[model samples]
Target: MRSLYKIVHTTCQTGWGEQEQRIYNESVWMENKGHQVVIITPMGTPLFTRAKEHGFRVHGVSFKRFSSLKDYGQLKQIFKDEQPHILNTHSKADSNIALPAAKKTGVPCRILSRHISDPVRNTWNNRKIYKQLTHFIFTTSDYTTQHLQQVFKLKDMEIFSMPSGIIPPQDLAPKESARKALARDLCLDATTRFIGFAGTISKDREVDTILKALKLIQSQIPHHIAILGEGTPDCLAELKTLAKDLGIGEKVHFIGAKEDVWPYYRAFDCKVLAPGNKNKIPLEGVPLALLEAMYSSCPVIGSKTCGITDIIVDKKTGLLFDPQKPKNLADMILDTIANEAATLERVHQARELVRKKYTIDAMGRNIIRIYRLHQVKIARQYLV
Candidate 1:
């Protein structure tokens, strides 16, 4: 029999966003594949409940967002109890304590999943800690593995890459109903095309720039933008007010956080993302929102950054625009609207790419392959 216990160390719940989605989907799919999968994380009540809700067992370790060692002891205790053949860690916190403990316990194999492209603020020290891990896993092709190889000074092959594929819902909602609910929220008119964006929309989103471009865009084309997801409310309101100042205030809708974002995608004719790279932390590694939009066959337009190039083939799979040029972004949106057939073709290509390359069944198996390569297989002897 083979079993694996995964410690997702991220201080977040599944279904919320990227990391959560990856953790949840991988664990659930692995369990369905007949592996005894258990997820360890601090947000126990929710993560655990959701895991069981999805038909998998979960182990919770108390964790603090800023401190990786906060759950060190609890994690060690779980390690002893579960006796997982491999200690697979997702969060840096789990790696801080779990990696070394796995070595101490003679767990045989310890692996770390590096889902973030952005450099951690404390990366100087974190790289040193990463050296202890048995293997490193990356979710996208552009993780700067060579840079990490130089910093960690390990073999070039020590770092491995495996990007996250899309995880689609069992059903998609009706198009007209989804559009009605969304259009009503934005008070959008029949003439206005709603360009929707989901996930983290921080100031770094250059949303102000998007708002600025809106003034120019509205002159040529009437459109509404919906920026959804939770964050600093004051900051978000400030962005909305910026829209008002730009005379596109009412046109730019800022809806706060969501538990379920599928309908949001269905409502959108095109999905846009402005996640930015900041402080070495590249806002990347295959965002779930963009993947979901692609599956829905919604046209995707994004800034060319980090792992985005691996997924988006500009003018082929989707359109790419310069992050610094709001005018370019606006023009791309206009072009997409005017060239509906071409934009729709991009959507078709994006969907085919996702169905072929990006999906839980596809990516999970790839990740599982690496985990199994180093996984310990014990033999039992029988005496007659």
Candidate 2:
């Protein structure tokens, strides 16, 4: 018989980022499967709002810093009262607080979901905290899991790799209707071959590369660039200047973060992900946005990176580009536009790939399996 578990997710994120969506998807699936779930986030934040909108039990606490005593007390008290089977936390601030609180409250499973590949500062305190955690959950496969194990030296700790899952759109509108709606909103012509880049507009995401590539093929293709997601005002301004410098300022449109980016995916001819090398913590996971695009039947041109490699089968499912070489990205864009029939075929195959391997249902089942396996392992250790 399947066991029902009480799962609590804690995060310090204020925005509706990948981590927030990931938890929301998992919680929905687990709840349907008879698991009780609660999400703890700061009040009035986008994540908190979305969790409430989705009917998930939510607790709002300040996530201002790592050492907020008041918030820590509240979190610890909640853990004690709830007595959750699993306390899953995302981000460093939440993880540090939740791990100790879970231990103090005698929570059986304390899993820290590390979403990025950024190296944690190797300090005595951090090492100590890492050693006490019950398990580490990595969103990416081998790259991040192996890197963190080496960094934190968690040879004995249990770890699991679960890629972030996306809920596919239920009613996919036709390409013409989507393009018409986007064009109407953005004031572009219907014939425009819209290229899109979704996710945060930070420097690490390399939105500049998309702008530069658009400039390279501006004369060759009747195209416009639509950048979705939010970023710091300074970073947004910097991208605007880059667009002007590349002489494609008018062709590039920044439609700040949207509650729904599926329509944009529907309108895009090709989706692109270009992460730069300059980031302190480089992009390393299979981006949920990439999976969404693939599921929407939009072909992708992703940088050859860890997570991207796992999904894209180089020219079969989606095209892979070198982030360092802007020209490589430009070439792929032009090729995708030129070979429309072949690109559509690839998009179809990519959709099948996402359906088979990356749906929310699949992710939920895998996570439950992990929980059960961990329980059995602990039971065996106790018997020994």
Candidate 3:
């Protein structure tokens, strides 16, 4: 018989982004697999409400940075009461509060999940948190794993890289059907070709590069670009002005965030991610948007940087371009359009890769394996 364990997951983020979604999904999967799961987040956040609605035990704490004594005390008491087999912390603020609490309570396995590729400062407090309080580290990409290792001089066995898995849609609409439905809703012509950009609409995402590339190729291909997801009002206005300045205003459609993005993925002729390389640290970690698009069989194009390269693989899985040069992105877009058969082949390969490696089941099993290994080590130590 398999061993059943209780797991506690904590996060400080309140928004319903990919990171929060991953935590919710992983918790649900574990619960369904006969393990008990609990969530600790700030009150009234989407994650807190959703987990509560789904019938999981949940505790809310303020998760403040400067004045976190109350939060730490609450977490410690909860850990003592529950005595979870594993305690996983998702964000920095929560980790700062929960890791020490879990350690004090003697939680058998403590994990710190690093979800972004941004650099970690080599501070004394960070070292203690990562090296002493936490038992093992989980990173979303090899980029982050190597980054943490280099910064804190952590050994390979101390950290593992695993991208959050996506749940494939059960009933995906046919491509033509999806395109026609999206066209009707967006008031576009049924025959209009679409290029898609999903995820946050921030400057760091480099959406202007996509707009400039669209301007360069509009006359040649006669395509439209759909900008999905929402951003700050100022960011939205800046992108709109840039599109108008480039004379591609009418061709660019900004459809804010959608609850169901699968239909949009199915409707897209190609999906793109164009994060800027100007930041001192890399900003991506195997983007979930690209994974969803690839699973939907949409040909993808991304800048050759950071975790984007982990999935794109240039011409094999999808195309890659330089974020610094809009013309390079334009050429990649044109190449995808002109070579339909090759693009389809790449899409097939990409979808297979996501299925084999990036599915929720795969991630769940890997995590459980880690937990079981730790359990065995603890048992051996007790025997000795």
Output the number of the TM-score-best candidate: 3
Please report the TM-score between candidate 1 and the true structure.
Answer: 0.85
lDDT tens digits, residues 256-342, model 2? 988788888999989999875434445667788899999999889998776787788888999988887889999999999899888
Question: Which regions of candidate 2 are displaced past 4 Å?
Answer: 49-55, 63-73, 153-157, 279-281
* Candidate 1 lDDT by residue in tens digits, 56-88: 656666555555565666666766877766556
Off by over 4 Å in 3: none
TM-score, every prediction: 0.85, 0.89, 0.97
Report the error of model 3 at residue 256, Å: 0.6
Collision count for each candidate, in order: 5, 0, 0
| Rank order (by TM-score, best first) | 3, 2, 1
**Superior candidate under lDDT, 1 versus 2:** 2
RMSD of 3: 1.3
Question: What is the C-alpha local distance difference test score of each model?
Answer: 0.70, 0.83, 0.91
Order by lDDT, highest first: 3, 2, 1
Winner by TM-score between candidate 3 and candidate 1: 3
